[model samples]
Target: MGSEFAEKVILITGGGHGIGAAAARCFAEAGARVALADVDRQAGDRLSEELIAHHRQALFVEADVSEGRDCKLAVERVLDTFGCIDILFNNAGITRRANVVETTEKEWDAVIDTNLKSVFLMCKYVVPVMASNGGGVIINTASGWGLVGGKEAVSYCASKGGVVLLTKAMALDHGKDNIRVNCICPGDTRTRMLVEEARQLDLSTDDLIEEGIYRPLGRVGEPGEVAASVMYLASSLASFVTGTALVVDGGGLAGSA
Candidate 1:
């Protein structure tokens, strides 16, 4: 496809690394002004610099997405710099590998806040801007676990499940305003988060990755692969898509109920 995002403004959270960073590059390369928000100042700044070197408009905002104030400030910075927000990618998230019994209150809170509440906070700020602008696209990062149960990952599953439903609710409430809300449910993407899950579960990262490849597609997904789905959902190509969980899971959930 040609540059579908030319002259557009895109805000991506968790843009410091992994899928978020990849999505930032994808949108920027497609000609969007990308504002990257993340808790990691160094990574975000470095990526922003790199994007600018590529002749794309990019800004890095250091903000903990778990806090509403930080979310508001990030959106404000984007608006102040870019003049308007055309796309909002609520991609900031963290994962913890613990069943309900094993998960502590603090850990649960941290995961839920980062992975779920962050979406709510970002939307609270960006939705109004999109409504004022007439229309926009919002893409949230959900997970395959959000749709199906996974062993020893209760909190992660719960948080992503919330994202899925939240996307639907936002789509329903905002469609009249020309804002489309949707989510990508990716499975076993090769990222730091996936490796950390292996460490948390006391399994070798190699073994964990091998097991992930047991899916019908015979391999774990790349961050760039998931980014492609985000691009599709964010662009005009998916104009009719909304309130849907687009699974980019390499058939991991295709055989399931």
Candidate 2:
């Protein structure tokens, strides 16, 4: 049952660290060949080396998913190296903690492009390849704010909401082609991004983490926990799943707004 991904080729954007990195490791451990794409070339290369050291087929592609050309080229590089792409984890993202009025155009564009449009660009290039190859799975990283609004993160909320709907729409469009589209709405996972959010709010990281512990499960989630959800979606375990927002939030969203 767990060997469902044996020899499958998987691509993960933003795979240099945090949840993306964890997801790459999970797939590779499950016997999948992995391509780790990120803007951080050093981290990606280092991770690829580590995976290969353990006898896993892994490649690192330096990519800024916000750019269409980079997205296309990254996919091409994966195909050139691995021959086929069987799963895609669109996990690249950024965040700006500001209300609509306080948000700059640059901040808005950067967040939207990275968190949302990158998914579109990646699918534009990879979906056809998946269809041509018979079928594939796509898992996107949304946010808890995507399903419910936050106080000062307007752009982030908007981008993630778009991701949720985009997942559903893509599922509707590609189900006939045997493509499964799903999004993961994660709560406050322990990552650099979570720490950055604290910095943006001028709060101490410890305080921020303590606040996150107020969730139903009494703690912020671990990146590896979120990666486990992604692994499930990418494997045959979720063969009947599509167009769903699997919330790996430690029950953070189970309560009301």
Candidate 3:
């Protein structure tokens, strides 16, 4: 409805639900054609259809972004459909609530590949396309735990921390090409991921949600709030913002160790 991103092509990984889905809606509302990539074909198809019903351009591509080949194919589909990618949101990630000793090697690999490797793979393909088209913005979803650490979430923390540093490193590598790379470190949000986190710990979702409100805001964040940050970074409003880990944690990290 808005012209903020009119005629732009946006690619979002893990875009079937949660923050990724919210970002897809936000960008489409701003007039960007969105390519929603997720392993859940059903969810991705449903969201894409909903966006299309609203007269927005959107495509769903089922992909296991953790794998290099799937990442390439997903980007290729987007390019073929939308011509060029103007924005890339490496927001696909998975979390495992386990300490190092409690975590199995399989779980560790899943967490790392989903949360960290996917970023590398998406950027690996999307970066050159953006560079060829002059420039673009990339926003990777990190976490507050990435800055500090979290108990029982060793693998998740490690992956997000890597995303933060990778964002910085990529910014340094691509600034000359006018490509801006950044990451967002969010606090607890009201998403299926948060509910799953509660389930992983054998805690009731409501109780865990309440505990998550320990920050100054005294409430969990909505996916839309996180999506707004992505919109800002993608827009010209944040033209000079790159290589920064913008924290949207509602003061949760103010005194965190």
TM-score of 1: 0.97
Report the CA-based lDDT of candidate 3 relative to the real structure: 0.94
Query: What TM-score quantifies how close candidate 2 is to the native fold?
Result: 0.98
Q: Per-residue lDDT for 1-257 in model 1, tens only? A: 65878989999999999999999999999899999999999999999999999999999999999999999999999999999999999998888888899999999999999999999999999999999999999999999988998988999999999999999999999999999999999999888888888899888877667876578899989999999999999877899999999999899999853
lDDT of 3 by residue, 115-150 (tens): 999999999999999999999999999999889989
Off by over 4 Å in 3: none
Local distance difference test values of all predictions, in order = 0.94, 0.94, 0.94
How much does each candidate deviate from the true structure in C-alpha RMSD?
A: 1.3, 1.2, 1.3
Model 3 root mean square deviation, Cα atoms: 1.3
Which stretches of candidate 2 lie above 4 Å from their native place? none
Q: Give the Cα error of residue 50 in candidate 3, in Å.
A: 0.1
Model 1 ranges off by over 4 Å: none
Error of 3 at 29 (Å): 0.6
